[model samples]
Target: MLPNGKTNLIALDLGIHGDPIKALERIVQIAKSGVDDHVVARELIALSDGRAETRPVLGMFLGGAGLADSILYCRNQIYPLGLSNGLSHFLTAIAVLVSLLFGIRARFLPPSSNPVRISLIRDGELAGRFSVLIVTTLEKLLLGTRTGESQRGNMKLMAVDQSLSALLRLGWASLFRRMGKTKMQGIHLEQGDTIRIEGDHSSVILDGELFEASEGHPIVLRSTQPVPFLRLAA
Candidate 1:
């Protein structure tokens, strides 16, 4: 039940380690309560549980400690909407490295006739929305480390490189197609920004772990409570 008013504020003690899906369900319930009640869920969020491929890649450009916080801060405050300059350049570097590695790895896989359409939205904006044909979609291929079907069970290290590479190619193609028609957008992450990935049922690799998600059940990513990260003069 929700409190009576134009806005309802509810706090849940989801525990130190809680399930995100359950929390999302609770928020959904509050949203559906009364037409007049406005629900806003606010709290401090930490970085993901463990380290991911992106971590090392980020650490390569930036530093390991507080890496996510650094990326979030930079992307939010410094970078622009398109092409991305300043700190957002890290994302471009990551994308390039990821694409190159994946292209090399792609030769080993079989080709497929049907391609899937994957839409990547950043901060409620279409950054890179594309439909590409390949043996396995980039998202799937990156998350491939999680499944035994990929025959890469012990292959833990290459997740970031492979995933980012495939994603870069896809996003680049999308950018070219969107050029002249609309403003070309690239993937940029920032603090307080929410990334919604809808369509195509699959898992996303974060901090070297697989987060299973499905179509319509989009995964929303946000960062809170900036930590002491990527400090150079330590």
Candidate 2:
């Protein structure tokens, strides 16, 4: 690897899943504006402001090298909700003709999300099962609900058991109408709360990494000490 020293957090929108030139085009526009990096974040963040398209930007902002003695960033970003953004994001990813075909299919062949049993283990006490468990500190968009500033660090869970079709409806609501009013059977975990997920076989995406979640084996989740993350000051 090439030798490195200072901190540089570069976010680009080039990818196979989404438009590769979107971010590059924005970068060129920013260059022509003759502005400094201080204004770059505002311009970049605006691309996703109140819009569906977004990239899962994840990292640990460890200042200095990986030395143990260096100061660490005190922030964590986690989103356990399943994949899928709003309709605008979906529409941008494909040809217009195919988009129409898939849109029709989605209504008739509405998707399904397997039921997952989540148990919150907090402060040596095991809380009962919850049908929905969503944890996030980064993304503002997902599953039709937005977390307030105060709710960022806590994990939200729902004990109200919902039918399979209801879960599907809730998910579709997120995709079609994000800002539109919808309900979430939700509650938050206290700081330092741990959790265990048990259910049929499935997979999970953590920090952009995927792992197999087999049946009969429950996955336990615990929050670690906050690591450093690069956040451009507004």
TM-score top scorer? 2
lDDT for each residue of candidate 2 in 138-208, tens digit (9 for 90 to 100):
22334434433322233333232223343454466557763235454433233223445555543343332
Candidate 2 lDDT (Cα, whole model)? 0.32
Residue 161, model 1: lDDT of 13
Worst 10 residues of 1 by lDDT: 57-66
Candidate 1 per-residue lDDT over residues 76-112, each given as its tens digit: 4435445435335566344334434454323222211
Clashing pairs in 1: 51-207, 52-207, 52-208, 66-229, 98-165, 99-165
TM-scores for all candidates?
0.28, 0.39
The parts of candidate 2 lying over 4 Å away from their true place are 1-111, 123-133, 143-145, 150-153, 156-192
